[model samples]
Target chain A: MIEFRMPSLGADMEAGTLREWKVKPGDTVERGDIIADVETMKGIIEIEVFDAGVVEQLLVKEDEKVPVGTVMALIRPAGETAAPKPAERHVYETFKSIVNVKEEIPPVPAPAHEGLRASPLARRIAAENHLDLTTVQGSGEGGAITREDVEKAIAERDIRLKPRPAEPAPTPAASTENIRMAVAAAMSKSNREIPHYYLETSIDMSKALAWLAGANRQRPVAKRLLPVVLLIKATAKALREFPDLNAVWENGLQRKAEINIGFVISLRTGGLIVPAIRNADKKSPDDLMETLTDLIPRARALKLRSSELSESTITLTSLGDDGADAVFGVIYPPQVAIVGFGGIREQPVAENGLIGVRPVLRATLAGDHRATDGLTGSRFLAALQQLLQQPETL
Target chain B: MTEADIKTTIFQLLKRIAPDTEPSTLGPTDNIRDTLGIDSFDALQFIIALNEKLGIEIPEQDYGKTGTLEQLIAYIKTKER
Candidate 1:
């Protein structure tokens, strides 16, 4: 039996509430099937199972928040015979003790004023009326207080106290604050743990941009490629030569087998998410663009699959459109390196005695010093520059 | 299709690509990216959606021409004819 644990979606995610189960006990699941929806501060993400098996048991119930690596379910591997009853009992007893150990470590108690299950609107209404949320009865799902409940409470209170004018309700700020905290925790951990080495290079993109314009002129807008696509492709291609940069630094450097490039996309609300473009090196420019177009929408909507969230071998961040001259990204942990691209701008260039204004892009690499040195990072950047120069090949 | 019909169709397409956009606030001359806050990816999806819906192919060279709602509608109207 293989235990399916709650996979860490990102460095920031410590725990996730198992919102819903797409599969039940005794259900046969295939690899890549979304087995559950996990609610994190980011949003509800569909968690995909990596192993194909029959779900032997559901260890964690829906709506229970579990820490990363906590076993959520047990899967019986396909073609494996059921264990004898006595053997099963022995396994169950061991599992029970493991769970008991977890239970022994008491969780941080919720604050007195914050533990009540009240909606933001309800909380606001109760606060405006000087009503305590714990005293207000909830009528919504999971016995959470709704706006109607607050209104009902207000109506009952109005009979005893003088009616006051209702103030405009405060907007919900929990999600934004939560995201900020998550980002803070992750960045702090990265800074404290990872010994980072930063490298930056300016690449002349006049040829690449010109080539792109000419190439795009022939294709329909739907099939048109962007410079970012080329950047991703070049980065992926370069990783093949400098595999050290495309690795995670745990106790030792663990080089990733596939080149999965994570692209950081900033959400409209607040914060950002790095979702991977799986097997980016294998995709054509058109295919990469299509995947990117599809990925961005789903990512913003919080509909990204678990694999997209977790399977990045290295990260690529671009502030090109945002007009940043350069970016030095904090390496997301486990993943040792992050490549950043700045806006392409026309700059004076002297090439072999010829001087002209050309579009230049600043690319930066932040790698774990333990995993790779500056020479390796520089070589990777050099390869990337060469790839961008030959845009047709990308 | 009439210009009004084209505009309506474009709005529907934009709504699909950017569901968070408030249609009431959108103006004819407003830049979709600036007004609706959609990135280049969403912009490409919008172009793809228009192509699929109207059976018209928009060249990448004309991307600048379709910056505003009015420009996009006008471009589509001309293409439909």
Candidate 2:
């Protein structure tokens, strides 16, 4: 017997409401059959199966929310004399449905495929409104649909479209207010309650930067390494030695783990987006650079599908504007620490009893005192500057 | 606009938002919010006011430490500058 589990629709989204069930118990289902619909963070998505089998039980009922790995249904071989090989094959098979249902009025009823059947009106309305009927929790007998169900689905769908109304400019305010609310609550608490201490350091990147320029001239367009990438790499490596900065302050206590770095990329329209590069501490500076440059453009455009917006524990904000020498960044919430990168400016400085114009960046570390102290934070920043100073060892 | 002009305008707006507000004795040193108890919800109200008063799209990312009147003025001043 094969257990048909609720599919993982997004990276950070763990569970979803079972909007509806297209197939029922004892229904003969085939490979690629629409088994049930689940409502995830993105929207309603149709759930399908890859193995032809007999439906023995529906573990989750309509309108019930279940975790990503929760079993929603059970499937067995098509024939009475069944084999276990088909079930095994489907277990390892992972495929995602990318159908965007936009026509709210519904389309010609999609054939039930096997024994499943839906009203032509319900199908057409679903296709027109872009509602995935799999998610509609049918109140009718044998899990059939009713007119009220379609209206309810539309009301729920209307929430995302709420900001797109008569006024265009205020809509951005509506959208951005959500983000500000989250940010303000955090900064206020950090400033008002949490004991925070800030430390600043400067990094000299002449040698490593010269190497980057030469390497970029020889590398392909997508393969070039940027300075921000090297900074992330150095920060990650240093985090390994200074585990205290990677800790989180929660429940009046400190919790430590390997930190993921969120790179804050500004969108052209005004908003800023943070995308996390997971387990970056172990990756080389060059590799970190490549990932940062690649992920930033995608994230900034809001092109990230549900799965792309995964979880991250820490972040890095860079003000690499063309002419600016330095910029400060605010910390993202629930994160105990955030590192800022100023524009690498050329300045004269004395080193080893001699002074020369060198490329440098003013780095700032704002940390929560509950998790880290000024000494630990300073040492961490010092180690980070040291790593950026020498890239050949990384 | 001059830096002083921007500061004056922010102060004027902040003054109107908090009528019970005392004459702002603090300058760049004072927290933009502490003088008025401007919590997160107040920040949204301020953004709405700024949008109406300034004809700008003040993104949330551009706001975080916008706690001090100077910081708010700095943000508005920089946007125009």
Candidate 3:
């Protein structure tokens, strides 16, 4: 049997609460099927199973918060037997005990609420209102507290303390605060550890934009390409020439063969998420645009998969239409470099011995000094500029 | 379609693109995209959806002209003729 553990969604994530299970004990699941909805500091993320197998057992209960690498389920391999052997069960039992022993003690006394059962929603409501679960009586199966019971308790309490202004309803700010904290933690760790070096360059977008407008004129609005797709493709192609910039510094510089570009999508509420467009180097500009169009909505909805969150070799942040002239991004570790693109604007340019107006874009790179120096970064930017000038090749 | 029908259709399309938007709260002259916080990608999506549902083709140059609610309604009504 293969152990299915809780995956660390990002470098900042330490634990995630199992919100709901999409599979049962005997369900057959394929790779990339979303098996559970996990609640992390970021938001509710649908967890995808990486291995195709027949699920043997679900070890963790719903609403249980567990740390990274904690085994939550067991799956029998696709070609394996129908059930685990007796010896395997014994080994599983021993492993469970060892894990249980290492768990931290709860803030509440364990004996007080022993054998007490409450619905997940009721438990959440109680915690939000600071109402003790032991005090609220359950009216569910086996006398477990239902959501109504918690609501009734809250109502009664509100009546007892009437004449005061009603308490404000819970807002999305709480979750946004959680996301802000996660971003702060990751960025602080980045600033504290990584030796950052900054580089900036400007590329004229006359040829690229002209080609794009002509290309878009024949297409429908749904299929029309955006300039950001060209930027992503050019960055990916440039990485092919400069291998060191496409590496992560984990103990040593480990260059990744596949180019997974983590494009940053800012949420409407607040904060941002970087979800990867896998194998960006191999995708055409149209394909990249489609992937980006789908990715932005899903990232905003917080419905990203596990691998999309964890498997990015490099990150890209673009300050679209209304942003500043240039942006220098912080490198998200263990990824060694981040590329930033500013808004494209018309500016006076002296090119080919003539001064004229052309659309110009400022591109910036922030690299970890330990993994690469200024020369490699300059070459990468130069290559990126060269690649953009010939948009048809991309 | 009548002007009222166009208004209703536009609001429905807007709601689908940005779920949090409140139609009653928006001023007629206010920029729909700016007030609703719809970015460039979503704006393009909104336009595409409008084209599919209303059978009105909005060109790239005219995208900026349809920013406000009244402007979009008037534009679509003229096209429906």
Candidate 4:
């Protein structure tokens, strides 16, 4: 029996609440089939199964907050027979002991709080903040105090108990705070663990932008291509020449075949998610724009698929039209490099002994020093610039 | 579809695409993007919905002409004719 555990969606996700299971015992699941909806710091992420098998048992119940790597279910592989009940129990107990035995034992509901119906996440958050559960009111189904309720109480307490400082207050929204915490943890881990080398180049985007404008003039607004699409396409094309930069570094540098470029999209509410446009190099500029247009809305709505969340080989972040001229990004863990595109601006350009005003974009590369060198990164940038110069090709 | 029928269908489609948007607040001259806060992606979905529901092929070039409620209705009406 193969143990299906709660996956670490990102570096920061420690535990997740299983919101709902899409499958049950005896249901056959494919490798990439979404088996459950897991609520993490990222939001409701559809969890995909990696193994093709018949689910033998569902170990965790819906709405239980389980730590990362906690076994959520047992799957019997296609050829393998169902293990006898006694033997399965023996294996399960041994496995649980091997992987945090204490977590395997569910928290027994306290007798004093017999009628209290708090979510596991709420309980954990309440304990962390030293809040009394009885005093806090529940807004969830049947008077259950959710994570949001605990966070609300914490925010209120902070305002009432302490003298206000001049500093801007952090967002009191529980989900937003959770997202910020997750991002912070991931960024911290990335900074601590990854030795990063940064390189940047300003590419004259005059030709690319001109071409895009001309192209867009011909198409309807709905079918028009954005400048960002060209940037993504160029970046993906450049990865072909500098494959080392398009890789994930675990034990060693592992090169990915498909050039899936994850674009960092900031949400309107706050926080950001990097969902990839798969096989970006293979797609035309128009196709990439269509994909991006579809992606951004769904991403903001928190409706991204499991593969979209997990399959990025490299990341590209473009600060929209009003952003700063340059951005040095932190590399998301697993992926070795992150490409940042600052806002395109009209700048003075001197080319072939002639100085003229041209639209330019600042492209910065933050690469894992362990996986690639500065020379490799520079070459990648050169290719990207060359591709942008030849906009038609992209 | 009649002009009134087209308007109702478009409203239904818009509601489906952006349920939170108040249809009554929108006017003929109001820009859908500005009024509804719908982005290019949402607009593309809207176009797709129109195509599926009305069986009209809106060329990419004409997308610019369909920004307002009046513009969209006129564009669809012209295409249908």
In order, the interface RMSDs are: 2.3, 16.9, 1.2, 5.3
Q: Please identify model 4 stretches exceeding 4 Å from their true place.
A: A1-15, A19-39, A43-59, A66-178, B1-81
Local accuracy of candidate 3 as per-residue lDDT tens digits, B17-63: 77767765668899987788777788888889998998888988788
lDDT of each residue in A1-394, candidate 3, tens digit only: 6656676544555777777899999999887787887676755566776567788878667776777655577777688775453211111211111010012112222225467688878877776654556667778889888999989987875553333332233256655666676677667768878899999999999999988998889998789888899999999999998889888887799999889999998877888888998889999999998998889888876667767876788999998866789999998878899999999999999978999998999999999999999999999999999999999999
lDDT string for model 1 (A166-209, tens) is 32221335555556655665666678788999999999998899
Error of 2 at B32 (Å): 35
Worst 10 residues of 4 chain A by lDDT: A94-103
lDDT of 2 by residue, A1-394 (tens): 5556666533344566678889887789877887776665433567667678788767666776666655566566666554333221233233223222111111223324343345667666765554555557777768776567766886775553242222222244433443343334445544555566778887888877886677766754335456667778888888888776675555544545756787776543345567678788778766776565467545533455443343456678777624256554555545678888887888887899999999988888988777777898899989988887787666
How is the predicted docking of candidate 2 categorized under the CAPRI scheme? incorrect
What overall lDDT, based on C-alpha atoms, would model 3 receive against the true structure? 0.78
Q: How much TM-score does chain B earn in each model?
A: 0.90, 0.75, 0.91, 0.94
Clash pairs for candidate 1? none
Best by DockQ: 3
Better by DockQ, candidate 2 or 1: 1
Model 3 clash pairs are A138-A144, A138-A145
User: How close is chain A of candidate 3 to the true chain A, as a TM-score?
Assistant: 0.63
DockQ score of the complex predicted as candidate 2: 0.02
Which candidate number has the best TM-score? Answer: 3
What's the true lDDT of residue A95 in model 1? 21
The CAPRI classification for model 1 reads as acceptable
Better of 2 and 3 by TM-score: 3
DockQ of 3: 0.39
